[model samples]
Target: MRGDTSNYRDLFLGDVPMMDARAPIEFRKGAFPHTVNLPLMTDSERQKVGTCYTQQGEAAAIALGHRLVSGQVKAERLAAWADFARAHPDGYLYCFRGGLRSQIVQTWLREEAGIAYPRVIGGYKALRGFLLDTLDRALAECGFVVLGGMTGTGKTDVLAQLAHGLDLEGHAHHRGSSFGKRVTGQPAQIDFENGLAVDILKKRHAGHAHFVVEDEGQAIGACSVPVGLHQGMQRYPLVWLEDSFENRVRRILRDYVVNLGAEFVAEHGHEQGQLLFAQRLRQSLDKIQKRLGGLRHQQLAAIMDAALAEQARGGGVEGHRAWIEALLTSYYDPMYRHQRESKAGRIVFSGDEAAVLEYLRRASTMARRPDPGTSA
Candidate 1:
């Protein structure tokens, strides 16, 4: 018999042992949860086969693949499969598709080792389908609370402090911004959503507390947010953060400079990026230039220039606080005022970071409280 194929859906839904038969590079790009690599072909082997397929056609590549897998190599692979099967007796395995690679491994496990582990019907493709479907369903069912504020209001930092659930924090590894990409590579979009799905499922299973997340505008670096989730965030209830311009700039410098490191900025042509950032900053400042005037903008420019100089000199935190304070007061504050006036929402509560955390805590508490009308 075919063992029990009926449990495959359940296996996929929950965590189940799986294997990626692709090269390490392909696997690193994205992979299913609980997946181990048991590649039939090594990285160079796959590349060679691919080159043959392109140059010599399918027949030649297939013949070469067969030749490569025969003899001692095949015996060692069978031994490894036997070990893996013994370790994860109930596990399923897959390749890019339900193809020859999976068949060879499945046969070794079942026929030789007498261990039955069904292959995924469509392999990684099926897992991709499931991930997309789950994310779409989540978008429709879940409530979202968008955390919005000007740069350096510590929106991401505050999200961490709050007890509420977050989807993007762990996957992106940094707050979403032009500089969001860290020294480490980000998770692939599929892996990001995989992590996101876990967060969403946990929140839903706990009950319908609104999921708190930062107001990211679609794509974050190389990874794109799922369209459904992105759409939901736009219409969701929003909590706008308010902070002193001085304080906000201070926070931005502290967070970005200290955490990101001065060398990072220098290595990436920090001065040039800062100059461009200043131009954008100047445009935002242009709206209020009538009130603050060109001289104020120039003063702000001078402060930013000085801060960059201090950073280049590897100066500590001394001059940074005062410079950031001036930029926020003279620049970032007025822009926020215009934004606040235009926003539409029942301002549930507002204050600095502490107040935001307090509100979220209260909201979470209310969500968990038993309703008087519904009996347990």
Candidate 2:
């Protein structure tokens, strides 16, 4: 029976002969489609069991679990299982593994209600194996197009605007920066990968010629890009966006305001935010610091301070544009130039937002063209 249990793909793709069972949190983190959580144990109960395992070993923990699940509580759990089985008549059940806990639940469900819930042979472990296998397959077979640029080039924004491609940064809920945390929350590492896997699967299913993604380091915020996927990305041709320093700064300011809102300026206080932004500016100016030393940092800081104050005082378009351009030319441009030169296989596309969007659209269309002599 265990040998005949369905794989995760079969279950998630709705090919399963039965409904699937897992815990609610686990299901939310990642789960097969059409799955249900009939938690044999609550979150606190699971935590206590884990603590017992660490302090008292598996045998003692198992005994404690049995002891804790007794009387009315046990009866209620059995009743819930009966209800679930009725609702999902052809459902199968699984715990972390096709182990004793699952056996206990299966036996109770059968004895009390005369309903048999098939158990996944290796349970969650088998599902994990399936996910890993699928990811590896995707990494090996997919054609990737890497979008590369320095900070504040709006690489993510451009990627989003492009049609028919995965947005890796969006999936990770990060801007891929020193200060990239979302205003809401970040996804757990497992959840991030699960979302990424969904995108990869969708692209593959569509027979996409290639999927576009931002050029990212090994990790994005709290989530680590899988090694296989990272390697796959590195092999693809790179598309580098070139923008004027003035334009880049304007873009960054606009992005920050849009994503973080006026409250960001208000919360940090215009003066403090100005100071921090200047400090970042100085760091970006480190190459010239040796010749100019402390004086350079101070000069840039002062300029940044004044510019930020103007913005605070409602320095409309001109003031904002001037400040952003100064920082970009005096800092971002040089840094990006050095880094961009070091990268290989780059196809440079120079333009403002609309022009860049047009370039990507053209590239995507060309990639999708059918091979000559291929059957209709």
**For residues 67-161, what per-residue lDDT tens digits would candidate 2 score against the true structure?**
77778888898888888777876567777766766777888888877877777778766766666665667566545677777667778778777
Cα lDDT tens digits for candidate 1, 1-376:
3452433335554677876666677787778668888788888888899999999999999899878877898778777777776787777777876677787778777787787767777777766666565556657654567877877888877877765658475566645654455545678877887767655554554564456887786887667777887887777777878777667767777665565554344655677554444443335435456766778767765765676567557746455566557655566566666666666563456677888888877777776522211110
Stretches off by above 4 angstroms in model 1 are 1-17, 42-63, 71-92, 109-121, 161-164, 244-250, 262-315, 326-336, 345-348, 361-376
Position 122, candidate 2: lDDT: 81
Candidates in order: C-alpha RMSD to true structure: 6.8, 6.9
lDDT of each: 0.67, 0.65
Global lDDT for candidate 2?
A: 0.65
Best model number under TM-score:
1
> What shift in Å separates residue 83 of candidate 1 from its native position after superposition?
6.5
Best by lDDT: 1
Clashing pairs in 2: none
Residue pairs in clash, model 1: none
For all predicted structures, in order, the TM-scores are: 0.70, 0.67
